[model samples]
Target: MLFLNELLDELQSGDYFLLYVLVSAIAISVIFAIIGTIVSMNKLVFIAGGVSHASFGGVGIGFLLAYHFGWKNFIDYSGPIYSALVFAMFVATVIYFLTRHQKRYSDAVIGAMWALGMAIGVICIERVPGLKISIESYLFGSILYVNSLDTIILCILAVILSILFFVFYKTILSMSYDEEFASIRGIPVNLLYFITLQFISIAIVLSINFIGIILVIALLTMAPYIMERFLHSMKQIVMGAIVLNLIFCICGLAIAYQFDMNTGPCIVVFAAIIFFISISAQKVLKKA
Candidate 1:
């Protein structure tokens, strides 16, 4: 309690940048919670991973084109963010079509794609002469570097995701449990799958700044998975996960601020500890 009070006091006295960071974190956490719940229940966590890393290819493409065309306003124009969105959506669609038939080699194909994206990004980045892109930020995350633009993007996404969930909650829940049954009931299984993947891609791209590509999967999966142990209904799981995500983000931000550490790792570490405890408690209950 004392710690939280101190943190709040500091934020009250801090600059506008700190306030921006807090807002961004909350918005991103909300999006992640809902999207993560969908990804978890639909059993598409692996696809989320593919989309997250595949966004780097888009980043690389943005830089390659901007540098080659002498576009000096890449930073001001959000060139990289657009490229990532497009690239992530494309990859998500491709993965969906390729793996829809449940081929033995589907996982292999996604793995290849995962590697190809990183490889392409590295090559493109290396080809850009005098380019000084922050590869570390993309891979490891840099929440402190999130600007107003990023926050706006995340806020819009959160609104859109919330509406989608509310409008199609029944269909989405049915699909998550049984695609075959959903199709039998005339639900457009393929379309819902595609839309889900699209949302997953967007969430992953936006999350790069807060959790980075490497750790974004963990952030998206672990919280909901923890909530799942105590909740049977999908709605309950999502609501619980959102609360847990906010807690992790706030606590992590406070710790990072106090120690001058990276916010992404701090958040993930806090989540990891909770996940461990949840599993341990479940085991103990089972034994009893």
Candidate 2:
């Protein structure tokens, strides 16, 4: 009806950026859900969390370089961003390799690295001058600002990540379920671990512009974790995660539009509410 007509009119009037932002948010949520499920199954949540937060360093470096080279345009900035992501992925891999053998203090090491990465990002941003963009948006994502390019990049990354996941699904499942057994059966467990960490790093980098570094970890881990409780299998978990993510995105967008709120925080808050309800329901059912 009338609402539908108005929606169509908005689309025709080039005010569809909100829709694009929702799409990008869903893309990010799906990517993180996949990564979160994989890492959770493997009991490597801390490491993945580390990689997620550490990606801010990549953003800082990219922004600094882009500003220095007078490349404020999107196309010119893409290269440095990708290069910084490559560096972040390398750092994540090295951290993984270094801490993989440690038994008691691995989380501590990863936490230290995460803090160091954020510190470096802050320092880099402070050193850079004449940058007009708000660093907070990059650190804590303002999804309302996502443009067509961001949406396209998100879709492309999702497709590529999906293909990679499908090709190695069984092997990765095996490794996550039982790495020692997977290694015994010649499953290349170490290589799989490294690739998973790299994938997580890349996803985090891509999501920095939508969810911010501080809140990205929640979007990456919480939605999937909540859905996993209700789903009986990995496939079902993924499906449920996507559905929940879409719901949150739509509701968040509507709320942001109605209340003049920040989109990223609104989305995260919606996710938190959903998570709380899920957990409470589970508790009630268990009591019953």
Candidate 3:
């Protein structure tokens, strides 16, 4: 383990941002691991994708308000972030209602919403007079943009989410695999679903900066699913996912930095490699 003084020395060095990267990765891993487990358990991976892209609408709205309407303070003062949260929650709610009884059509509906949000974001961004950042930053993760503020926000969200997971541990576990049974046990199944999906929305919005919307689903589902093949309990699955995500993010960032590559896609490629390897392991272990 890194000693405190040594850690402090490293933080003060020229590569201080490395600390930011490490913290951001760990915090995001914690949030994604827990959320991913719930998402995979409930089989809402596609909906999660919809929610992730839906956040782009909020991001565009945020930039428009800040640059077009003089809400610059509002944008960074949790404006765009909160707007994305609201937009994502709205999309998640819509998906829930639309698919509640129309299971056969959920995919089509979610795809429509997904495209709609990205379109809105693109159009809104086009109106910003002097936008400095590229849309790809939001689309494919921007390593150069990782800073102290983003790291702090991620840390705060991670703590809040961890607390929530603890408080609703059993309820979530029960609902994950069997919502009907959870409802039979008097757990407000619908309410929990709405609330959890909302949480997932905010997570995606915040995580956009680190991993981008394009790869959010993989971080939020692939690791959890891979762990499921070996782990039997939710806690173990989440823990294993945290470790797996850390590996993907850290290794991806290192490789990206060394090769001048896009951070988001690099991270996802590592995940894809691991996912395939896990498939092989699953087959081999099954025969064992």
Model 1 per-residue lDDT tens digits across residues 140-231: 77765687788888889988888888899999899989999999999999998888888899888877877787888988999899989988
Clashing residue pairs in candidate 2 are none
Q: What's the lDDT of the predicted structure labeled candidate 3? A: 0.85
The weakest ten consecutive residues by lDDT in model 3 span 1-10
Q: Please, what are the lDDT tens digits per residue for candidate 3 over residues 21-126? A: 7899999999999899999999888899988987898888888978867876674434566677788989999988998778899899999999999899889888
Off by over 4 Å in 2: 1-7, 14-16, 72-84
Return the TM-score for candidate 1, rounded to 2 decimals: 0.93
Between candidates 1 and 2, name the one with more favorable TM-score. 1
* 1 against 2, candidate with superior lDDT: 1
Instruction: List TM-score per model, in order.
Output: 0.93, 0.89, 0.90
lDDT of 2 at 79: 45
- lDDT tens per residue, model 2, 140-231: 77764677887898888888877777798778778877889899999988788887888888887777767776777777777678977877
For all the candidates, what are their Cα RMSDs to the real structure? 2.2, 2.7, 3.1
- All candidates in order of TM-score, best leading: 1, 3, 2
